[model samples]
Target: MTLADHHHDTSPSRPTGLGALGRPAEVRTHPLDMTSTAEVDAVRTALADAGLLGETVRFAFFAPEEPPKSDVLAAAPVDRRFRAVLLDLATGRSTDNVVSATSGDVVSTRELDPATEGQPPIIDAEFELIEDILNVDAGWLAALAARGIEPASVRAVPLSAGVYDYPGEVGRRIVRAFGFQQDHERDHPWAHPIDGLVAYVDLTARTVDRVIDAGITPVPTASGNFDDPAYVGPDRETLKPIEITQPEGPSFTVEGNHLTWQNWDLRFGFNEREGLTLHQIGFDGRPIVYRASIAEMVVPYADPAPVRFWQNYFDCGEYMFARYANSLKLGCDCLGEIHYADAVLADDLGNPVTISNAICMHEEDFGVLWKHADMFAGSAETRRQRRMVISFFTTIGNYDYGFYWYLYLDGSIELEAKLTGVVFTAAADSEYATQVAPGVMAPYHQHLFSARLDMTVDGVGNAVEEVEAERIPMGPGNEYGNAFRQKRTRLTSESQAQRSADGSVSRAWHIVNPSVQNSLGGTVGYALLPEGQATLLADDASSIHDRATFATRHLWVTRYDPAERYPAGDFVNQNPGGAGLPAWVAADRPLDGEDVVVWHTFGTTHFPRPEDWPVMPVEHTGFRLKPVGFFDRNPTLDVPPSRGGHCS
Candidate 1:
């Protein structure tokens, strides 16, 4: 399903009279759909009715709603319900409330201790309070002035405050903040690092708790501006313009959020947490994936500098970076025939806001799908390949990430994350960083994205098996040499299934519906092929190791549980350790003949070079899912060949 749209007009997917949500009213809201702005007000009203929400308590987080049980989803249409978390500023306690949007009633409530369960995700209101908090604190201003940078030169931006063993920060809603010098009005702060100055702002108290100045390292004066004319003298005229025109228009059709292209049928939805998510993916009316999304990702820096050591960001869970998703531009972000879908989400004040053309969908010609030349028959046949692309881009701090989902003419699903942006910089003395410029050193980091694939190959009763190409020894049955076969091992349980990508052995994990069979009498399946890059470089003893255990392995298979959506647990803001996947799979749930979800960790470990300075080029990383036993034969035999159009 594709949602990448290039148009920023007041356009929506479908006509719906119900509020500002793009989802059509008749099309019943899927459990994976985004929480509507109308539902946010209904939830606030419902909480107030139960005397849990008021002036003293602030809405901390309304996380991505969890679905009902597996059976309930396959049954009749269900009513709309939501679960929200609120923090009492007076007592530093979080109360979880489940509200029914259908009836506008509060169904359940539970109070959690910040000391035990970690604090809720950072809210938008809390970020808004930072400027006021910093402006009032004279110490923060003095710290900025001490670095020879005015307080007005840097903005008081709030960041996801990670956890250490600090006694004062324990059990508090903390947001780590720092400053970057902007000498001019349009200066990019990322280029100039006001290093060694950090502040811990307590959101609950609405004050700057403390500011740490680890001796001011020289602020980088290099200009990081790439768009300005001052950076480049002239434009290159060597490259000519290429036009991609589908005069007949794209083959894909969209009705509301539902998308159908070639033989594939799927639906896509968006939320504040995860920008774009796909659901109900099927090929020729046979189910493949029930729900799929980029559930969580961690960007952990390897530098050990005090100001940079605690640099790990959970972009989706902690910051809800999707709120900052870019409204894609036409010729630049997408080309060819495009279909755009407008995304709607609630603002900090529970008001509806629409990011027009936030999602983009397009098609691209991909060389050839199949080709054959028969010398005996004096005939040649070739069929070109084309894939439908669905993507969205979001900017978080210094980096911008683009998550793309591509569906091909054949039964294949692929997710590609394009990384491009200015790299986070520090002073040039660190051993773990590369001095990209005279004074700017970019640290080494990894962007490990955990893709959650809720697969239902033919049905929910599916299992995962690790497939590897094993080399047979040169003996026994083979007296000569050259004997190799594949070894398939059914992952029976959760703990035993934790594995790494071994490209040396050509390893891949396959999700198969063992209960179903194809024409060859083999189990219907799809294979997950990873690029097999390195996992988290952080050791098990590090704090980030505990918070992002999902990155410890390339693959993790667990029985489908609606509650287990996030890989790094629910509250990853300031988690200590052992909370998410590591804690959930400790029970070692059996995965045989059960509905299972595959979390594939795929990313690149960046060691910045001189060419990566200023603005870095796009680096690509992703995984693929191809039909294994699901198809009896070639699925694209009916595809027509291109007509003759040659140029001299």
Candidate 2:
């Protein structure tokens, strides 16, 4: 039944029986909320006692939806449960054991597909081992000495998902070492590269594979003058922090995994692959999104040279997205009264490792939301825009990507990613370099990211409708036809939903529940608005093309499946081709009036400019899913006005 049809009141303060009559006014804690520290420890202890917590038999959090649908979760009894994914490293067999956190018992067990075992995340042990090799290994030390570099001057960071074409044993992690210059106390490491030399470490073998120097002349070290007080430019002075005070209290409240802001509510969680996930979202107690996450991202380098061609990487599938999370500093990554959420990741040995301040939640001023000046009335009305920002940053090799999910008072949601940090460079002659550096060529590349949005609309089973604004033909009506019309088409199946952005025309797709209707008799839905998109430029027959078939389409709609979390398949490193989005959608399942997951691909084609040298500024790109006919009118019309004085 539609929310409006049910005349029942569902406010949290007053209990109301629910069974399609209406849902709860307040949000409930999602079963998929991030596992807590005690829960992690308890599960670890249980597995340890059962002799399942070892290097070979490891335990990981298994994300699963509760038996009952999200719409009925409020009426259902509280059943706090967790599942532990047992992965056998030797045989690669996986099992799912449902762990009752409340009862502290393994309630049920089931076997999972062998391919369901997620790739081991890059852990502290891997980094520590590489550091030990650089310091203790005689050969590595000799190579550094030969380059006239001291151990203290060189800083090594893990370069994950490095191209590995070696004929090696199975289940070995090949980590590439990227060294940085650490000359001064205040110098940032990325400002200098020792040049040419790279160390390959075999984590499984616990040995340095080989140190090879590419045949290229070493370029001069870039300036680390960012910290130098004398090297100041216009607008270089640091600005003072503008504090946002809450005289009473915040307009939001967090209860366990559920957060309620104004009229919006959502449940958030963190996973190793997807990083931050928002589940069971609602506005005014009406279901909007069932689940949403940054599913997978592929960064492919355009250079065709031997070493560079294979440098293409699927960051999410290869290296765990959450393991590389940047522990955000209070005044740096976020501002104002910030709420921090820590993420717990399993180590190589399956122990729970907590990364503090991995996700930051805060509110920000988003400029003017709405303004009108009625000269006839001799007055103006304006409502200042403010948005809640949920953000996390991950440092993958030379690049730091800030992933932000913003919720606006206007019932709009935005997913934005900012790419900042040093560029992965190669030595080149001054003639070949035009944009990034004189002697160093910052290789042409594209960062393609896919956001997996599982929309439930009012509840489950939503349909996708593509709407395009087209100009009306002049001859059709035999009159002055300087007008446009909207062409709406419903994508009824999976194959029909796989679409590309037709940028020439104004178009948008919506996830709508056919049963729900707005006050104007329009289908209630959220519009998928793609901003910037960069398709894969690699040859269709290329290896990189096969690795990431999800990039071929701008949007992919598929039937919801818990196992199909990743776009580029489970294992992307050194993988010729296996299972991915194309293979998963080969079933051609029906999508209309079914649980659907929408994959939105947005990216940037980075042709590095000269200013990108040293450290590149943050390049922003992403998409938004805004409310269309979901509401009766402007959702922000009732927002309170700012009481602060305006500057003349």
Candidate 3:
């Protein structure tokens, strides 16, 4: 028997029912019914098992690049045109609002000519295609359910043009058209551009179910010492009353020299020193600050068209205002004031002494000064006088987390004015400079000299100390009587790196006494060293003074980390106890005893409101510094009166 010759047709005979050719074995398990909740759950479960849950399962749909082809393109025959007119007459009104159109509106015709039709058969065809696509997607979902997959949620977004331009309204329209309701209604649209139209079905097990039932109701009336009546009275507001959406683990504690606070259950904190608690305040409260409405600010610049312009104008305005408000409240000002003068005196060793006491202002004032400089730079008369006005301001807020306990969170603002832009001599170019003597010279590098201000938090409490100092080189300079020149190198490398990386570097500069000498027979001004104590020698006398110093101000804020489960949102870190402080205080070189001064102002931040949620509106508030004579005269005395009409 020739076994090899025996051939049996064993191609796995097709099933009696629908075979793989009709429907794949996998898809054959489920029917295309989308109404059943059980089917939906099954689909979600299947998707989760396949690791296609949440963001991974969204389906994106793309339109064909080319338009559909037709057999006839020339002018239609008389009968065909007439038929098109009849179809158009019937469906013309239905086309006004596609949202209301039904399956019946879909008209199939062999006329093949759209020119004669009111409902240009093309539109009906397009509608039918859309319906088919939707049905197919629904079937896929049903199949997933039959596989025992349950999806978290199915979100359908229309990828048609003009949909994203007005998201808030368009999103609502889509929801209404699709017969789907949003868990929470958002005033503005949340749609963003993707590669194409896609339905994202999130099927994650972690879903937020804890609902905060009580709405945030604004207090009709409140009064406090702060003039703007919007301030909630000292004892009025309480975080305990409001229910937080999510409460997490035990409270965390942050302790520092000037401030300390404990995070509580509601994401609020209790300030130990102030005996008050901080709550997340929203924009709905009293007008604590001056603000510009988005409509008033953006309308004039938008198009005049009734619908499109207003809608766009409002959306644009909200977005801009939100960003501006957040930055103004939370961002830090790093730029410091520059000072210069006529004849600065020097000490015996040629170091510049009596550095014509100039005031350093905050970044905001510096911005004003910069603007003024630009406007007045063209004036020949102003340039000749060399009369520079150095401007800066100081900001103070309750010690980090200080607002946690207090009823009224507050910040003080102070403006400082001084003359800057005056040119000074570099240490390398001075005649008074000398070679470094091995044993006698303290250090060849640059030295930072500062003075300490010791004060007690309370009369009975331990003395809390703060340091202030002026940075000046003692190596070469003339006293007030002589025309002395102070020489400083351009430090091309450091300057270039600093300029290029502006605003990105976070570490502060540490000032230390120098010990090395260069071949040029001159000592480097300030030595770059770790944050630690260094002795300051008087410009004239080689006497060294030992001073204990630390950072007086640090940029600290409350931020939420998505990973943490504790008080939901809380402050995570406070960087202190370092020698090199923030850049606002000059780094790279040490300051002369008179160059450094410690000043502070305060500020507050609040959560955004529903009105502010889509786009926040701009708000403004300012603080005034009483005449403390930090300057020789009232800094604002010389300021010219504002051009009458120019006041904002």
TM-score on alpha carbons, each prediction: 0.92, 0.82, 0.16
Looking at model 1, residue 107 earns an lDDT score of: 76
How high is the CA lDDT of each candidate model? 0.80, 0.70, 0.18
Worst 10 residues of 3 by lDDT: 395-404
The deviation in Å at residue 498 for candidate 1 is: 0.8
Candidate 2: tens digits of C-alpha lDDT, residues 173-241:
566675666778777655565556677776656678777666445544656455465653556458886
- How well is each residue in 133-234 modelled by candidate 1, as lDDT tens digits? 887788888877777777777755577777787888878888878677787887777788777877888887878888787887898888888888878557
User: Which portions of model 2 miss their true places by more than 4 Å?
Assistant: 1-30, 55-119, 131-172, 176-189, 194-201, 207-213, 228-241, 349-351, 375-379, 430-438, 476-481, 644-648
In candidate 3, what are the lDDT values of residues 457-511, reduced to their tens digit?
1110111011123344444563443443333323212111121101222222211
Best by lDDT: 1
Index of the highest-TM-score prediction: 1
Q: For residue 539, what is the lDDT in candidate 2?
A: 87
RMSD of each: 4.0, 8.8, 33.8
Local distance difference test, candidate 1: 0.80
